[model samples]
Target: MIKCNNVQEQAQDLCGEIFERWRELLQSGEFILGDQVLAFESWMSDRCGGAHAVALNSGTDALFLALRALDIGPGDEVITCANTFVATVGAIVAVGARPILADVGDDELLSVETIAPLVTDRTKAVIPVYLRGRPLDIDPIIDLCRSRGVAVIEDCAQAIGTMIDGRQVGTRADASAFSMHPLKTLGGLGDGGMLVTRDPGIAEYARIARNHGLENRNESIRFGINSRLDSLQAAALNIKAQYLDQWLKRRVEIAAFYDDVLSTTRTGTDLGRGKPGNAYYHYVVQSTHRDELQAYLAENDVQAAIHYPVPIHWQKAWLSSQPRIALPTTERLSRQMITLPCHHHLSDGDVEKVVTLIKQFERAVRW
Candidate 1:
């Protein structure tokens, strides 16, 4: 079966070089906060066009640290889209803050307009997620937050290389948290994440916060956690980072192929076009018969999945005594979205086969 992502295959291609560097790191015995970590941080900062980048253990920790660095905690509420990975909301709750769920736009990604209604006196931050490699229209959100003194922490887990009007996602937000998980556009061998910020002070504080909030070797400045990206993971990530642009190009090509092929099929009249700034992380499409389409793809040897089927507000863990606020757009997307295969490993032939299979499935179910 064709997997949604092939991180192991990509890593295997670079494992030799990565292993050699890993050996050097192991021999040096400077494991945590070493030269490799520093180099990766600098590389990521330059790539994201941020003043500073702090490497962390996971994307969840990156979000948590970003929140902590900004002093957003407890009685504060963070405005974020309901239709996102639980990690986005989990980070907010983990940091002792309330997650204010907002609806997504027509493109099925977070937007400033949908977020405006969620903002209030208790709202301290906004995390506009770049879901499925599609860069959310964040400029307006950033501007709105700036005018209201609310911090913006972009959830750029799937949009590592995604650009908005030539500027990267992390460059626009007050801080952005990126996941280098195996499924992301820039996947690492293991769990890894980075926080990017234009403010040196925030970056410095996050750096400290990632390592148990210690100002120095033995001095504890504040409460923090052990969230350092392992040296081995960094080495693997650096190796993969070298070929990220090429991989991203391949994904774009595959997504284009899907668009061309799926457009002609009698699947659904409305396939829902991606926004101009999207990078097609998962190449999602909207179909009224989403469940049926997914089942049909499975029968035809095509693996398809849903980015998120349940909105955050509906989750049992996040439920509160507060009255349920209706989010029509998010609720609608939760039922209509299906993600198709769009990974770097897919060849032109693979794209054609997947698209053809989807078309075949659509034809079988056109009732």
Candidate 2:
């Protein structure tokens, strides 16, 4: 069976190094905000073009902290894509701000064109999510936000190590949030996240806020949440970080194969192929027969999935709170896109099988 990702195999491969680090942490007794976490943060900073990286418990918290550090709260409005993971919009709500959903381009990512019309006097920040690890040409978005005095907090949960013009995506924003959930490109053993920024003030505020606003053991400067990254997970992440580029390269290779073959199909079409620096977090294709194709893959022991079956604006949880808006591209893409397994673990034969099965399904549906 060709699965989305062979996480266990990757974990097992790194167990020896992870266990060694775990044993060291166990003996040292310095758990929270310890050496392991610092080491990982240092690596992240260097990789993300010298940004100050603040390690946190989760990516959602990373976004929330970025908003908090920027003093974006009640009465402020945050603009983000409607097609992104719920975390992107949820972070705005978590910080007591109103989330404004923006439509996406053909690349399934937010652009200045889609977002410019929605900006208003209350706009506090713009979180352009690098969905599916496809890096946005963010300079224009940054320019747009900068001219209006709005902050750019990139939602980089899926796009770690993705570069644009030889620089990483996270470095260009006011602050960027990255997730290390087990499924992410730079995933650790468990949940972990990082906030990257060039601003020392934002970094300092996040560092202070993440530890319950602790200036010291007995001092509390302000009310804050406990969002510290675990030392054990950081230790595991430090080990996994070494192989991230290798894994990403493999994923790109797989994506290229899928793009080459899937482009000719009458029933399915690949999106966002020509974009450079795409990390290919999910190899997505749009097909009118999405449900049928997914079932066919499952029957053949080839696992396929949906990145998102529903857009955020349509989600029942936010229906009443969210303004009724039309996101034509987002709504249509959600129903048509199917995510195929595009991971480092898949062999050449596994990829070929997936493509073959999809083509077979395409042929069968022609009638």
Candidate 3:
């Protein structure tokens, strides 16, 4: 099957390096959080343009802790894209803040224009996501938030290698959250995440907050949670981080191939093309017949999935409390986006086969 992701195959290919790291970690006997975790954090910091890094248990925690570090809580409003993973809004609600959903532009990304009008006195922060690893010009967003005194926490969960004007995306915001979930370009064997910030105070707060808010072994500084990155996961992540650049390069090549071939299809709309900075976490296409197309691909052994079928605001958990807000573009696109296979594991032939299958589906729909 042409799966949306090939984590097992990718891990199998790196079994030697993974086993070696695992062996060293097991022998060290310092497994919880140690040199390995610290090393990974340092590496991430450097990758994010020298930002102070605090490794966490999951991407969700990274987002939650970023809010904690910023003192954003109850009664405060946090603005984020409506069409995002639940974790984005979950982080805000987790921190006792109200989540304000903003509509995305045609590129399916948040912009200063969509966000500026949402800012108010209660606005504590704005979380702009690099959805599908497509980087937007964030300088304007940063400038807008700065002038308004609202913190900007970039949700870089799907965008580790994503760049803008030669600098990585995580470094541009006040604090950014990243996930090392196995499907990510720089994923570890298991779940892990990192929070990057340019501020030392926020860095110190996150460091303590992740470890039960203890400044020392005996003294507690604040009420915090246990969200430390595991040494085993860190060890594997350290090994995987080495080949990230090449993996990203391969993903872009596959996305470019998809763009070139799929662009001609009349029923489907190809997005994120011709952008050098896009990490192509998921090569997405919008079609009026998205469900039918996905089913057709599945029949042909070509796996395609939806990144998110329901916008966060429309979720049952939030539907009761969230006022009926109009996010036309977000609501409209939720039913149309389909995530195709675009990973480093696929070869040229694999990509061509998938493209051929999609073309076949498109042609059949035309009739």
Candidate 4:
């Protein structure tokens, strides 16, 4: 069966170089905040068009640090999209802020129009996630936040290399957090994350926050947490960083192929699909017959999944006893979305096979 992503195959292709670097790092014993970590941070900062980048243990840490740098805590509310991964909301709540979810656009990214209504006097920040590697419209969001004196923290977990109009995603917000989980566009072999900021003070504060609130190695000036990136993971990430552009290109090529085939197959019907603007982390398309198509694909030897089957507010953990406000767009998206394979490692033949299987399923169900 064709899997959604094939990280093992990609790792195998570079194992020799990866292992050589890993062995060297193990022997060095300079683990935390070492040369490997510094080099990776510099490389990532340059790539993301930021003056400073702080490497952390995970993407969730990156978000938490960014919030801490901005001094966001209890009594503050952070506006974010209801359509994003729960981690986005989790980070805000973990930092003692209330996550005020707003509706996302049909494209599955945060919409500035929906955000305005959610902001209140207690709202301290807005996190617009680049969901599925698609860039959200950042300029307006930035402008809106700036006008209101609120911080903008971009959740760029899936959009490591995505660019809008001309600028990169991380460069657009006050600060951006990127996840290097195995499934991300610029994923490392193990977990890793980075925080990018143009503000020097914010960068400095985040650096201290990632460690234990130490103003310096010998000084503990404030409360902080231990969230440093492992040197071994940095070594693996440095090697992977060298090939990120090529991987991004291949993903774009595969997405184009899917678009060509799926569009033709949908001819007169409304599949509710749009041409993706960047890397296809997940080639999600909307349909009323989502369940039928999913089961059909499974029978035809193609593995498919959903980006999110439940909106944040509907999750039992997040629900309250009070009657919930209706979020029509978020509800529709949860039921209609289905993601197909669109990874860098997929061959042209793989793309063709996936498309063929999907078309067969659509026809069999008369969708």
Q: What TM-score fits each model?
A: 0.95, 0.97, 0.97, 0.95
- Per lDDT, the best of the predicted structures is 2
Mind sharing the TM-score for model 2?
0.97
lDDT of 3 by residue, 135-205 (tens): 97689999999999999999999998889987889887789999999888888888999999999988898
Per-candidate clashes, comma-separated: 0, 0, 0, 0
Taking all chains together, the TM-score of candidate 1 against the true structure is: 0.95
RMSD of each: 1.9, 1.2, 1.3, 2.1
Residue 348 Cα positional deviation in candidate 1, in Å, after optimal superposition: 1.3
Candidate 3 overall lDDT versus native: 0.89
Report how far residue 363 has shifted in candidate 1, in Å: 1.8
Question: Which run of 10 residues does model 1 get worst, by summed lDDT?
Answer: 266-275
Candidate 2: how many backbone clashes? Answer: 0
Candidate numbers, best lDDT first, in rank order = 2, 3, 4, 1
Regions of model 1 farther than 4 Å from truth: 266-274, 320-323
Clashes of 4: 0
Q: Between which residue pairs do clashes occur in model 3?
A: none
Who is ahead in lDDT, 1 or 2? 2
Q: Which ten residues in a row have the lowest lDDT in candidate 2?
A: 265-274
